[model samples]
Each structure stands twice: as structure tokens, then as C-alpha cells.
Target: MTTVELQRDLPADPERVWRALTDPAELAAWYWPERMAPAVECDPVVGGAWRIASAPDGTAVGGRFLAVARPLSLSWTWRWDGEEHESVVAVTLAPTAPELDTPDGTRLHLLHDGLRPEDVGSHREGWVSCLDRLPAHLGADGSERA
Candidate 1:
């Protein structure tokens, strides 16, 4: 199986970052395509169901939460609308160094595993765009000065 991994540092604390990931409202604000009217439902607990409406189609895509460790990590199954196969996504958050020039923030590590080789590139691009939007959602812009 192919895997996609991404890491990003944001000028926000772990708790704030955790909320952004687990909270449906926060997710709706930045998770979906910009042109789409965001619609999301998330149950932030292990085994809970989550769903997000896809752009232009309004079809929902989601799965159950596999793991939920508040302010630290989360893992879930992912399946798009009409797709039978499922992939897995895991996110881990940790505190960044305060001693560094950057302000105290959280480091986010994301792993998307169990993808078909052909799906890897698209998933990677989608994830990169999503991650790039995260810091702006947090009002940090991924900067130390934020």
C-alpha cells in the first residue's frame, strides 16, 4: 500500500490545533474545497462517525474514528462517496520548541496510509492543499510572528 506523510508547524498551541482537527465547525471552515458550502458532522471520540459533504456534488464522505487522543493524536477511516475501499488517516500533534526563533506552537504530523499506488499522487496533492490552509485557519499563517 502507498502512504503519504506530511508534517507542518503552526503558531498555535496543541489544544487549539486539536480543536481545529476534531471540531466540526472548525473543520467546515477550512477542510472542504473553497467553492463548496461546508457541511460536516464529527463525533470526536473513538468509534464515532464523521462525515463531510463533498463539493459540487453534496455527497458525504467519511468513516468512523479509529482513535482519539485529545490534543495529541487522532486516527480514522476514510472513504469517499461511492467508493468501496477505505483508507486510513492519522494525525499527531506535539509542542514545538519555545527556545527557537519561532513562537510556541504545535507540530502536526499526518499519515495517510493504505492507498493504491495510483491514488497516492492525488491524495498527496489534496492533503498538501488542505494542510496549507490550516495555518491560515488558525490565524497563524505558519509563521513565528503570527
Candidate 2:
């Protein structure tokens, strides 16, 4: 199995980044731009389920929460529409140091494991696109959008 590992130092704080991950509205804002309007159901608790379905593309992504630690880390199972196997996604957030610049910033680390090697490229692109929009959705103050 292959793993897709990505680390991004975001302009927002850890709390704001956490909200973007678990909040339905915040997710809809940046998850998939292809979805004009997304139907999102997110329950950020252990054993909880989360799903996001898009309209035009008719694509859906879902999974169950395996672990949840608010404002810090979370892990879940991930399976996309028409996909047979499910991957494990683990995310960790930490505060950026004063030296790295962006004083009130967050270092977001995401790990998606259990993927076939053929699936890595697409998964990497998908995640990169989604994460690129996260900063904008985090808002200027970081908390307002939460």
C-alpha cells in the first residue's frame, strides 16, 4: 500500500484550521469547487460518520471517524464514490514557530494511507487543490468563518 503525505504551513491558526476540517459549512466552501452546492454531513466524533456529496459531478466521499481530538488532530477512513477500498486519513496540526515567520500560523500535516500506488497521483492532486483553497475560507481573522 502507498501513502500520500503532505504538510502545509497555513496562514491560519490551529483552531481555525481545525474548524475548517470538521465544520460542514467550512468544508463546503473549499472541498470541491466542482460542486456548486454540496451536501455535507460531518459528525466529528469517534465512531461518527461524515459524507460529502456533490451535485453536478455526482461524486460522493464518505467515511467513519476513527479518532477525534479537537483543535489538534483527527483521523478517519476515506472512500470515494465507486471506490472499493477505503484509505485511512490522519491529520495533525501544530503552531508554527516565531522564526518561520507567520507568527499566528499552523503547520498542517495530512497522511492518507492504504492506497494503491496507481491511486496516489490523483489523490495527491485532489488534496492539493482542496488545501489550496483552505486559506481563503479561513478568513482574515481566522475565527469569523468558524
Candidate 3:
């Protein structure tokens, strides 16, 4: 098994970013590849179930929450819609250094572990695409609606 790890500094505080990760409405805004409507639903609690799937049951990605530390960390099991491979994904958030940020921000770290060797690249690309769109959902002033 291999792991995919990524870190990105977001222009919003951990609290705002955390909403984007756990809120069903927020997740739908920027949790998917560009040009695809995301159907996301999550309970944001330990033992709760969450899913991000292509609209109308196209291609689903879902899992049960393993850990749900609000505004800080989240971990869950991951499985694709019709695939047999299963993996674990964990995300951590923290404040970025003052020197490295302007109006305070979150340093987001993600880890996807236990992937089959063959699935690494696509997962990496998918995550990159998702993260790239995250900032847009977080308003420039950080005061935008959740």
C-alpha cells in the first residue's frame, strides 16, 4: 500500500476551512473536479456517513467517518463507487505562520493511505483539482457565507 500526502495553505482560518470540509452545502461548492456537479452529503460527526458523488448517482466516493475533530481534523475510510479498493483519508488543519500569510489562514494537510499502487496518480490529480478550487469557495475577505 502507498500513501498520498498533500499540503496547501488556504486563505481562510481553520474554522472556515473546516466548514468547507464538513458542511454538506459547503462540500458541494468546491469538493469536486471542475465542470462536474458534486452531490455531497455528510454528517460531520464520528461514526457518521459521508459521500461525494457525481450528481444523480454517477460515480460515487463515500465512507464512514472515523474521526471528526471539528475545525481541526477529520479521518474516514474511502471507497469509490464501483471499485473494490478501499483506503483511509485524513485531513489536518492549522493556522499558517504570520510571516507566511496575510489575514491569517489555514495550513491544510491531507493524507490518503493504503491505496493500491496503481491508483496513486489519479487520486493525487483528483485531490489537486479539488484543492485548487477550494479558495474560491472561501470568500476573499473570509467573511463570506458558509
Candidate 4:
């Protein structure tokens, strides 16, 4: 199995970043908006169940929250139907020290592991595209448009 990783530095606080990642309303502004359901439920706790279906109509976006560390980290199971594949997605938000290039912001790191090598590119593209929109979504004058 191979792993796909993506990292992005957003111009937002960890709390705001956390909201973008975990809050349903915020999620709709970016990540998979076309497929994000009304967030039937979210517990954000270890061993808690998490599920989000697609839009236009409901479609299973299989997964469950595995661990949570508030605005720091979250891990979950990931799988797409019509494919006998399962993987783990872990996201970590680390605050960057004050610097010329990087101010008080969080470095968002994401890893998708346990995927067959052939699936890496697709997953990589997905994450790359997703992260590309993140900064804009969280920017000073940004708004969710995904």
C-alpha cells in the first residue's frame, strides 16, 4: 500500500481552521460541497460516529471519526463504495511561530494511507485540489464556493 500526503499553510488561526474542517456550514463553503449533506451528526470524539453523504441526492461517503484532539488533529476511516478499498485519513494542525513568511497560522498536514499504489494519484489529486481552495476559503475576504 502507498500513502498520499498534502500540506497547506493557511492564513487563519487553528480555531478557524478547525471550523473549516469540522463545521458542516464551513465545510459546505469548500470540501466536497456538491456532495456534502446536512451533516446528519458529528460527535468529534474518539470512537464517535461520523458520516457525510453527497449532494444532488444522498450518496454514502463512508467514514467515521476515529480520534479527535480539538483544533489539533483528527483521524478517520475513509472508503468509497464500488471499490474494495479502505484507507485512513489523518489531519494535523500545527501553529507556526511568527516569521516573515509565516505568521500566526496553522500548518495543515493531511495523510491518506492504506491505499493501493495505483490509487495514490487520484487521491493525491483530490487532496491537492481540496487544499488549493482552502486558503482562499479561509482568507480575509474569502468565501466558500466549492
**lDDT of each model, Cα atoms only?**
0.87, 0.87, 0.87, 0.76
Q: Rank by TM-score, descending?
A: 2, 1, 3, 4
Q: What is the number of residue pairs that collide in model 2? A: 0
Q: Best-fitting candidate, measured by TM-score?
A: 2
lDDT per residue for candidate 2 within 1-146, as digits (tens), equals 99999998887789889988999987887887844578899999999999999887778999999999989999999999798999999999998886785667899999999999999999999899888887777774435322
Instruction: Please provide, for model 1 over 1-146, each residue's C-alpha lDDT reduced to its tens digit, 9 standing for 90 to 100.
Output: 89999999987889888888988988999987668877899998999999999667667789999999898999999998889989999999999897854477898999999999999999999899989988888874343344
Candidate 2 C-alpha RMSD relative to the actual structure: 2.4
Following a full C-alpha superposition, what root-mean-square deviation does model 3 have from the true structure?
A: 2.6
Clashes of each: 0, 0, 0, 2
Across 49-134, the per-residue lDDT of candidate 4 in tens digits comes to 66655655655555778889999999988877455677999999998777725587788999999999988998899789878878
TM-score each candidate: 0.91, 0.92, 0.91, 0.82
All candidates: CA RMSD (Å): 2.4, 2.4, 2.6, 3.8
Task: Judge candidate 1 at residue 73 and give its lDDT.
Answer: 95
- Displacement of the residue 79 alpha carbon in candidate 3, Å: 0.4
